[model samples]
Target: MFPGPTIPNRQPHREPWSRERLMYERAIAMGNAIDSTSRYTYGSALNSYLTFVRIHNFPVDPTEETLSFFTVYTSNFIQPRSVASYLSGVCNQLEPWFPNVRAARRSMIVTRTLEGCLRLKSVPVSRKRPLSLDDLQIVLSHFHHNPSHDDLLFISMLLTGFFALMRLGELTFADNPRLRNWRKVSRRSTVTFNDIQYSFHLPSHKADRATSLAEHAVSPTLIQAMGRWSSEAFKIYVRKHPVLLHALLFGADH
Candidate 1:
């Protein structure tokens, strides 16, 4: 009477996921997680690797030797740093299938090969020419007389970005017209004006990936420029697109 009827243990039956199905699901999840720009970069890298593989008839599962060869081959055309980036991109693309593929990029052979190529070929590192004061004056001269809304906006942005030392990404939208994450300069972010100097919070930047907001001082020149833009062009812009109150300070067509 003490023990109740014992139930027989039954194993639940389910169809196992196929390798292709698992890969597809993982890809979907990864695509959702990564930014569009990064995905494009990775895809480009993978394409380069695939092209190399096709030309050389290499296996899908790349060996350290194959990777080293690819690096050296690419180094002949591109800079060593670019070759390294391509290798990293290929590694990232393959990591889902081969977890240890990224390690190949870090191997001694790959490192030594890159170093040797760098020493052998004097590939000058391409650098962006820094904007000079003369350049700024030349640019501003165009908008000196009766500047349009667009001109005013451009002038203000140029000045603010230069003086603030903001990254292009921080100041402007993504290079792709389709993928724009416009950051708004809100009223709350701006501090009280004191003797023509005011501060505003930079919500996010490349270097400061964390949530910490950076405050930058607005020079009198920038303030005046902003005021001029806002008075005429900005007012018209706001009237045209009333919904842009909390949108990008420099609005785009979108």
Candidate 2:
């Protein structure tokens, strides 16, 4: 018999990634780094869904029926937005394992139920009252009379933050303080003179991530309060702990 025609060796074709694809991948990586809080929130929501399934003896596979029931059941205790957040959390957890399961969230029945719940359970929103100048005076007076180095620092932070529109996080460390490499106000950056103005740079803030070096002039009233606290008080406080000169405008004690 004649030998069959020799077949040519073949290799799998590999397509080069487009610029858009490369950029998309890089964007996802950066997004993952920044969404630590969202990850935690979604994880907590998934845990609640799992607990509900275990207790109710529902099927492991999420169906439209299951999601609809869950929305109604959860609505008794939580607002529609919260139930929606929980549903999103559950969907995120399940999508990897059951790629076709997203239909549960998109179901018309589930959507109608969520809308009905929102109408039934809605309440008027309450907002925080803004602080007035008089309110600020009372706070400053209390700290001024106390006259401890800590109290002086507190006064300085209050006055500067009020005028500058600074967030609490920028002015002070979180509850569990640790040194981070992010930009912060330093003593050398501060200019406390007859002018009574503060100048410091922030690498990032809640509103924006762009680097900002700003100087906010202190009001005459605030300047007098700062005098009572004494510039020497701040200098002495930083002297004992040199790190404060670099880490914060109002650094930690001890």
Candidate 3:
């Protein structure tokens, strides 16, 4: 057989990136992994860290001792819980620069210092009270007198949202057009109804209140799926109603 037509040697379409350039690109990719808001928060944390080091004449590197001290010092000004969040942000920002920053942050010294700060500087939690059926009834009474189209619409949304356990974001579009996401919205086309009841396709819903009602009624797996929880982190959101707790403790026979 005739020798295969000799192929001419061709140069690579692209040149291999230098090690330094590759490293820089990788760091950029790491930053892009988190949202812009999260990046801003992390950037603030890093700035705080840099300021701390500069003022104290400490090394820029994040060592266990430095991170621990930073945690304690920062906690004195902000809430200890906020300090913890700040540390998490710091770790995210610094991890690319100092590969072992996470390990340093997680070290026993840093963790214990953070824990001690929390105890030393304890603040009362100021959580907003969740809306109840009584609140719903009050709203209904307000609209009952002279319900305009807008008023009726408000009542309809209120009822549907309460039962569906929808978030405020799901119920309404953002005032800022830039923030409004059509993909997240539930349009009229998604709704269906019969004489008995009406239902709509919710693009997403992760109501903590749903856990209060369904805690005993459903399996943990089902609850997690409904809550769209990737981990057991949903436990933090769980606020067991006293009645539900009592029922769980006792039985249907009781």
Candidate 4:
């Protein structure tokens, strides 16, 4: 007789998913269009704004908000950088169809919220640092010592976030081949040449104000790892022990 023990069968008690939660499925669909944190951060900003809006029964959406509340919203945030990120997102959306949406230049708009340099009166926002080659090398070297899924996840983020210069929100995991494009970009390290590829068409910044923004996406190797080839389906690289970000494609930086 085989020495292995018999396995017990089990089934989940919870329903597959609730209807209200299912409603969020649309949001999930849209969320799936982009990376994970895009789902979180953008959703977080929207939730914050909407919570404030619903609380006061504000009649207008963020775009239609009177300048007064816009000011209040800015002053209330602990981190005005998020506000800037949110506004920049809206600006991106309006520029293509509604050119008149963003009136003040970015400097002026930010001046209204995030504080300016030289003690200029504006919002006081947080600061962030860009990753350097030395920093990235250190991260990879550490990963080499401790091989794990997180390591692969970070490698993808560094490739996209720094090399491809993708935003946090755009660097989502693509567990579905239907969405992610797997095309190799390089073969410099132990990673295979064909293993390189990333997302080809990542979701755009829903709040950007620029009229002619650059194409978005990340490195190819990342896409291969995060992007799935399923029939249909679906971090931070630095600081705070880092996190996840699916993958990127070609020179894309969505």
Number of the top-ranking candidate, with TM-score as the measure: 3
- What TM-score, computed on C-alpha atoms, does each candidate reach? 0.61, 0.54, 0.70, 0.33
Sort by lDDT, best first: 3, 1, 2, 4
**CA lDDT, every model vs. true structure:** 0.66, 0.63, 0.77, 0.46
Highest lDDT among the candidates is held by which one? 3
Q: Rank the candidates by TM-score, best first.
A: 3, 1, 2, 4
The alpha-carbon RMSD values of the candidates against the true structure, listed in the order shown, are 14.6, 16.0, 6.2, 17.5
User: lDDT score, residue 10, model 3?
Assistant: 80
Regions more than 4 Å wrong, model 2: 1-34, 100-103, 149-161, 168-195, 206-254
Candidate 2 per-residue lDDT over residues 63-133, each given as its tens digit: 88888888888888877778999998788777766776688789899899999988998665553433445
Number of clashes recorded per candidate: 0, 0, 0, 37
lDDT-wise, the better of 1 and 4 is: 1
Worst 10 residues of 2 by lDDT: 207-216
**What is candidate 3's lDDT per residue for 1-254, written digit by digit as tens?**
78764787585688899999999998789767875556777788889989999999999899999999899889878999988888888888877679999999889999999999889997878666566567889999888887999999999888877778777777887685645567787878978999999988877776544533443355555666776876656554543344434433443333
Model 3, position 243: C-alpha lDDT score: 41
Which candidate, 1 or 3, would have the higher lDDT against the true structure?
3
**How many backbone clashes are present in model 1?**
0
Cα lDDT of model 4 by residue, 138-253, tens digit: 88887887678877987876665655445554556356444443332222343433455644443332211111111234332333334322223212221221112222222244
